[model samples]
Target: MSHIPYVPASTRYDEIPYRHCGTSGLQLPVIALGLWHNFGDDRPFQTQRDIVRRAFDRGIFHFDLANNYGPPAGSAEENFGRILAKDLAPFRHEIIISTKAGWNMWDGPHGFGGSRKYLLTSLDESLQRLGTDHVDIFYHHRPDPDTPVEESMLALHHAVTSGKALYAGISSYSAEATKEAAAIMRDLGTPLAIHQPSYSMLNRWIEEGTPSLLEAAQEEGMGVIGFSAMAQGMLTDKYLGGIPDDSRLASGKVNKDFFTDEALGHVRALNDIAAERGQSLAQMAVAWVLRDQGASLTTALIGASSTSQIDEAVGAAQNLTFTPAELAAIDEHAVDSGINQWWGVTASR
Candidate 1:
């Protein structure tokens, strides 16, 4: 199929709201698009183009990526680069593109971790794959237990100071690590702009610990963008009738034990609450994470296989408020279900 000329909707910024990233002057869409799953080479390119275009049309200007997003690793960024060249190139100034390093991207000893070499080299490769001079936000991806926090943060400082990335971020760091990283970045004069973590109704690890990751980000004046806000699709209505033949759970990509009777029971109860609030379970989950529950998140990073999923996620911004009773009811079913894969990474520090 041949592609037509791209023209974004003139009313693109009419619906979704943008929130300031922490205390910074930069603002991001309350709901952003993440290419962690669907933008890989395995998926049809047309579908990826449609989803990304629809997200931009709906006012979601932030697009998230990483070095290892695709099944083959780096395919997501390459694919997204194609999309950028074909459709979004003209609107580059309006988009917020973020990519990360720190995960394994190559086989050699220097392929992974928070060391300056891997982080900077991976970022250069990311910029190449992204077809851009600089990303709006550059993240360290995760905490590296072996590398000194100073080394990792200094690399990020260099990323910004050298003009490869406009701002610096860290993902999956614990409360203590986040504070230390933020302090280092502050001392370096770059100042960590954001913290990305896995957060959903079922994976509430960010809400754990004495200071809690949320509180730490708040104190450091760093914005929060939560990934896996839908708990890898488990928080959606798809699992209500048991895993469908086409679902991620049925494909063995997600652990089968994650849908234990206990977890499903909680999901079903949460679904009822969503119904009462005139929202889908997925919408409720997104809203719950974006709500001002003590330490509010600036944005919720969402992945979508279809255009309608983008619509559903954007709808979350319509009802971000939760009464005390509604929050109480949700808390009952939102117990941790051992769904957070990054728990060990955050706890490693």
Candidate 2:
């Protein structure tokens, strides 16, 4: 499958920096591409391919995916694989690819959960779909209470040892579960390299508890990469004007119930602050998440529905810095919009 020979860009936006994943030798860009939306079966292949190339051109080297990210589950990986086989194969080792396997993928028991059977088998299928022999990071998409913690950790350990994954991570787990998983991974000699958690202006639960749990991993040497950093575009001004036709809300992918009047008010206020700072609402929202005072993060996993959005998001890297006063203003104005309520608060398991 010969692609139209996209000559890779020689220079990327220098504003975006790469940080090491915990104590590991791998470094991920501050912003990463996520396939949670827009890379499904319904979208055109060339368009998605263009978006992927644009992301890489801007130094977004990590692309995150999950088994159930598409409307027809597995389609995201299948689509991504097409791009990989065409244009990305030449830069495989230069990029860091990641995928998860903890959500529902099939109809029966083997389809989902943290059991060794599910996780391992899912990885093989994921590898096939992504057109890769191994992923840079393999994550347990979620914790399974029905399956023992040790069992899940062992599966992750196997992924690294078998050379199917360079590092292992867990997502959407409670603070307690994170600590326990980290401990077992440590004892098994795998040493968790990272934890993928949902974090955004509207979701501060991880800031309260999960960070503390990650501290133990940090001590043991594991970095944290936040996912959904924009709260499904709710943090942006896309919904402030009553859901534009081009917005995700208009696509019916995200539920309309999240577009509350209160959320819109907060977005408008944040937009005003962003205007003062000479940044777009989306830029400010992303800059806010990545702007760490002392404990800076390794990367932010974000999604884009179009190539224009991808360019805008990559440009937001320039607005990463904020002053003490600006930070205070954001804290005062931003709402942990409950868009990530399930993972940020009660739903974490």
Per-residue lDDT of candidate 1, residues 233-266 (tens digit) = 9889998887789887877778887888999999
Candidate no. 2 TM-score = 0.94
Task: Please identify model 1 stretches exceeding 4 Å from their true place.
Answer: 1-3, 344-349
- Model 1: ten consecutive residues of lowest lDDT: 340-349
Against the true structure, what is each candidate's TM-score?
Answer: 0.97, 0.94
Best by lDDT: 1
Over 255-317, each residue of candidate 2 has an lDDT whose tens digit, in order, gives: 787777887777788788889999888888777778874556678888987788888887788
Clashes of each: 0, 2
lDDT score for residue 181 of model 1: 88
Q: Ten-residue segment with the worst summed lDDT in candidate 2?
A: 340-349
| Top TM-score hit | 1
